[model samples]
Target: MSNSYFQSDLLSEFDRLHQQVASLFGGFPYSVRSDRYGAFPQLNVGSTDDTVEIVAFVPGVQADQLNVSIDKGVLTISGERAPAFGKDEGDESRRYRQERFTGAFRRIIELPAAADPDKVSARYVNGCLTISVGKAEASKPRAITVQ
Candidate 1:
């Protein structure tokens, strides 16, 4: 039946994706971003009374190399993680197997209008990048005094 054929095709496509991802990381990382192809850096996003906090997991990457920016209420995180060990020390290519992604990658997130980019602060520590975006005064919750 047509339904059976459709299911068969879908499964085959799934297998192909698995192989591609396996080759990318040489195997899966402990955590994965199902929506995005390739591995997405592990992350945690939360909000407090004053600001929104974002923490990104990026190991084997230098703190100075990362870039974080907010524009039009959209936060963009981008950076390049060089190979664990570089070439030039010895023969470059011709290795039997290679993995661990190298080069540039980017992730974009849309923030709410309350986010105040001008008051944003960011820091990198323990292989985690943390960004705090303050909320606009008008958007922040305030208590009203009774007359």
Candidate 2:
């Protein structure tokens, strides 16, 4: 076979293997970035000159139900959402449809090297959890004057 043809065949095989692996884990919605399809508490991450900001949309979770922490440059957000229809909903067979997510969930975010773990702050307001991690002093931008 020509070199070009052999390379194309190898690439196609690799692509097929990737698809098979993805299919095996298709049932799981969790991913490292926490942005996978159907992942709970969608997150938006951005960085400013002095801080890294993260916002998680959790419409039904309360402030007390959420927990945020940073360890070894990894930020972890975990919490539980109670069922909407109360603990006792007559019989399980009576329920026809349920779309809401109700249960414990944990999402881990890897922080940049410049993020200062000691300067992290988190707040939950209006169904949104906002987390701010201050950048290290050396990482902040500074204007240098020419001599």
Candidate 3:
């Protein structure tokens, strides 16, 4: 029998097929992260016994430029960020590199079923937008006593 140099493993073939299937479906798989890669205003989500906390890192954006709202258990954050360097009509300069995100952006977050839409609050400070959604009374932890 001749020795074969190339070998294809079952696991490797499965991984390759998965990638092809994912790409065929628009390259987006269901995940907890943002819908698209490199989404602006990266967020950190956490929870406490009383509330669900969401923090969005948005530097160089003013508080007045942000809009936060909740509808049907979905939290939406929309805002516009102006360019750092304003363009002048008379000055003609070409930008070599622009990394910062500018213009309108909207981020949607799905809240848990226990999240009370009526009890929601948001505040923006130090370029960070913090949103808190109170959990339903029924969802709160309680001590049970044996009768």
Residue-wise lDDT of candidate 2 within 29-142, one digit each (tens)?
342343444557789999999999999999899899999988888888899988777445544454578899899988777888999999989888899999999999999999
Stretches of candidate 3 off by over 4 Å are: 1-35, 86-91
Candidate 2 residues lying further than 4 Å off, grouped into runs, are 1-34, 86-93
How far is 39's C-alpha from truth in model 1 (Å)? 4.3
Arrange candidates by lDDT, highest first: which order? 2, 3, 1
Residues 1-147, candidate 1: write the lDDT tens digits. Answer: 467766567877998988786667543222212334454465777889899888888888898889998788778888988765548446466666666777787777677778888988989998899999999999999999999
Better of 2 and 3 by lDDT: 2
Model 1 regions more than 4 Å off:
1-39, 86-99
**Per-residue lDDT value at 26 in model 1:** 41
Worst 10 residues of 3 by lDDT: 26-35
TM-score for candidate 2, please give it: 0.73
Q: Which 10-residue window of candidate 1 scores lowest in summed lDDT? A: 26-35
The numbered model that scores best in TM-score is 3
- Per lDDT, the best of the predicted structures is 2
Q: By lDDT, is 1 or 3 better?
A: 3
- Summed over model 3, clashes come to 0
